[model samples]
Target: MPKMKSHSGTKKRFRRTGTGKLMRGKAFKSHILTKKSTKRKRGFRQETVISNADKRVVSTRLAGR
Candidate 1:
């Protein structure tokens, strides 16, 4: 049987933590920073766990990893 390949885009966007949870970057911090508050911008710097609904899908894409 051929080896299963992981999703390239998913691998770049998500990472597994020490405990195995998938961590992803918060969105909306990439452009038009002038209108966003400092607090909101600061929050975007932290990585957040994928939601329960999306966990299965994301993990499957990352199965080969």
Candidate 2:
């Protein structure tokens, strides 16, 4: 059987943690920085784990990652 092609965009935007959870960057920090507070911007710097409900779909595209 041929190898499956992982989603290129997903591969770049998300990653699987050592524990197998889907890790992705937080949103709302990329624009309008002047209106956002320092604390809020700091929070966006950290990666967030994907919610359980969305795990199945993400896992499929990230298979073999």
Candidate 3:
């Protein structure tokens, strides 16, 4: 059987923690930041965990053993 390749985009954007949780960047911080409040920007700067609903998909993409 052929080896399954991990999703390149997912690999770059998501990380697997020691406990197996997926770490990802918070959304809405990539553009139009000037209009957002300083507090909102600060909030977005924090790292976010992938929701349980999305964790499975991310784990599949990551292809961790």
Candidate 4:
């Protein structure tokens, strides 16, 4: 059987942590930085775990990893 392919976009956007939880980047940090507060921008630098609602879908997409 052929190998299953990973979702390229999901692979780039999500990552597995040491304990296996999925981590993802914060949105809204990629544009219009001039209007955003420094604290808000700083907050975006941290990675967040995927929500329980989306965790299953994301894990399937990331399965090939």
Candidate 5:
């Protein structure tokens, strides 16, 4: 069989932790910051853990990374 390929978009957006959980960036901090409260904006700045339901999809796309 040919080598499996990593999903380019997933590779760019997600990473696997040492323990195997997928790490992802929190949403909504990318734009329109002026309307959101400072606290809320700060919360979005933090890295987030990908949900369990989505982890399998990410792992498959990442080729078991």
Candidate 6:
């Protein structure tokens, strides 16, 4: 059987946690941040787990990793 390739885009955007959850970065921090408060911007620095609804789909894309 042929080897399954992980989704390149998803692979770059998400990471596997120690417990196997998918960790991803928050959005809206890349552009025009002058109006956004420092507190909100700081929150974006931390990683977040993917939603339960998307877990299965993302896991499949992540393959072995």
Candidate number of the best TM-score: 1
Q: Write the per-residue lDDT of candidate 2 for residues 1-65, one digit (tens) a residue.
A: 78888988889989987888799999898889999999989999999998899898889888844
Residues 11-57, model 3: lDDT tens digits: 99999889978999988988998999999999998878989999888
Give the per-residue Cα lDDT of candidate 4 at 12. 97
lDDT of 1 at 15: 94
| Model 1 segments more than 4 A misplaced | none
For model 4, how does the per-residue alpha-carbon lDDT over 13-61 read when each residue is reduced to its tens digit?
9999989999999999998899999999999999999899999999988
lDDT, model 5: 0.86
- Ranking according to lDDT, highest score first: 1, 4, 6, 2, 3, 5
> What C-alpha lDDT does candidate 2 achieve relative to the native structure?
0.88
Name the lDDT value of residue 25 in candidate 3: 92
**Candidate 1 on 1-65: residue-level lDDT in tens?**
89999999999999999999999999999999999999999999999999999999899999974
lDDT of 2 at 14: 91
TM-score of each: 0.94, 0.89, 0.87, 0.91, 0.88, 0.91
Give the per-residue Cα lDDT of candidate 2 at 6.
93
Model 2 ranges with Cα > 4 A deviation: none
Q: What are the runs in model 5 whose C-alpha is more than 4 Å off? A: none
TM-score comparison, 3 vs 5, better candidate: 5
Each prediction's whole-model lDDT (CA) = 0.95, 0.88, 0.88, 0.94, 0.86, 0.91
